[model samples]
Target: MPAPERIPSRGLTDTELLTLLAEGRLTVLGQVRGASNAVLHCTVAYEGEERTCVYKPVAGEQPLWDFPDGTLAQREVAAYEVSEATGWGLVPPTVLRDGPYGQGMCQLWIETPGGGTEPSLLALVESEEPGEGWKAVGFAEVGEGRTALLVHADDPRLRRLAVLDAVINNGDRKGGHLLPAPGGRLYGIDHGVTFNADDKLRTLLWGWAGEPLTSEAVEALGLLAAELAPGAALATRLAELITRAEVEALRGRVAGLRTAGRHPEPSGAWPAIPWPPV
Candidate 1:
């Protein structure tokens, strides 16, 4: 069979990109290096429009003792749905579909506009005190075994993401997962280990720990709470992706966070952070 024609990446709108994700002819571009299962970067083509996306096939996922097998891809899509429903726009456009590698979650790759590369929020420092706009997280070893101070940005969007993570019970919120896009926008990825029935919100965004959530952030939580109304569209969509108990856990987290009105301190219930913090 002849191959599908390609389209301009910059030309497609958000809605159009989603349509292409669902119906586009996916062609594997390459494998993305990571610790977990196979992650493919591909070109999604449809109706003369094409775009780059990340595909995480269920068959490629490494089995986890805690989370059920073959449901990581669904969780990826669920995270995106939550982001959309809450109007957070923290997660990129993701959809669950059958790809070249079988059933998987395919998400449109977010390109830095104007070809500008944004740095990860975790910045490395060598023996220098963290200046303004940055807060030290911990220490790290650099080249020649030099010790370096690792820090994260004090941006509000990150705080917003921190709140979102609490709501989803994100099990793994790595520094590398936080992508800084053009125009100062931040996008998060690698959400296959989320929405567990148990509390597993491991993250390195402790800069805002124990701090009061901003009014805007609190309002967003309220919006998410309302979206989970029994028979609401968001609730129905999530039910199709995650377990009923997981959905209920999401509701519980939202209510708990809203009641607290402050960024939570580590409960010491589980590991407070993920390994390889960056």
Candidate 2:
């Protein structure tokens, strides 16, 4: 099936978009292919305003050994909460509400530049070391027994996303999850596997592993630490989306980052990078 036409939500304020997604009339346009769970491409309208969105219903979630069943939709919303707290807006506006299929996550759709020719944020180069404007993310097998170094851009937006992923314990951060919207804004999606109480962070943004946290990251972490304190507003909101233990783990991660003052290093207990990295 042909893809639905992209509709930009640039004019709506974050508050307005969230309200529209939560209360608007949702019309499913098509199903997004390649998602492990059902992801519907839909348009949400309210009070004569409309915008494109992606909806993932709880009933369509596949059971994961690590994650609790029927909770992926909530996790997606939790990830959005954490993203918004960071002030980076790395995640598009997302909300959880009743949909045609059931309760699900509805997120504002982002429109990328035409022709899939948006400048590359990730690449595989023959050189062992990455050139300027790029950060090496280790190596990958290309085909025919050849290997190439995998790298992502040295962009600050990606760097911020890395920090946010750390806070959420994101277990998947594949290249396809990075959405480069118009006006240079970058957003990350498909956070259903996130916010686990365990150390399951897997991503291609490990380029800055062990580096000193950027001043901006430190500042964001500081604010997050306060907001995640027991009974804080953000904490209260998150408790509704995630388990209490998971919420506590999130607090520990932010505190740990502030104390370490550096990006997290892989613990070696699990896979450091997700499969099919791009």
Report the alpha-carbon TM-score of model 2 versus the true structure.
0.95
- Model 2, position 189, has a per-residue lDDT of 88
**Per-residue alpha-carbon lDDT of model 1 for 1-32, expressed as tens digits?**
11112223477766887899999999998998
lDDT of each: 0.82, 0.88
Model 2 lDDT-worst window of ten: 1-10
Question: Top model by lDDT, which number?
Answer: 2
TM per candidate comes to: 0.88, 0.95
Off by over 4 Å in 2: 1-10, 115-119
Per-residue CA lDDT of candidate 2, range 133-159, in tens?
Answer: 999999899899999999889988789
Error of 2 at 165 (Å): 0.7
lDDT of 1 at 207: 75
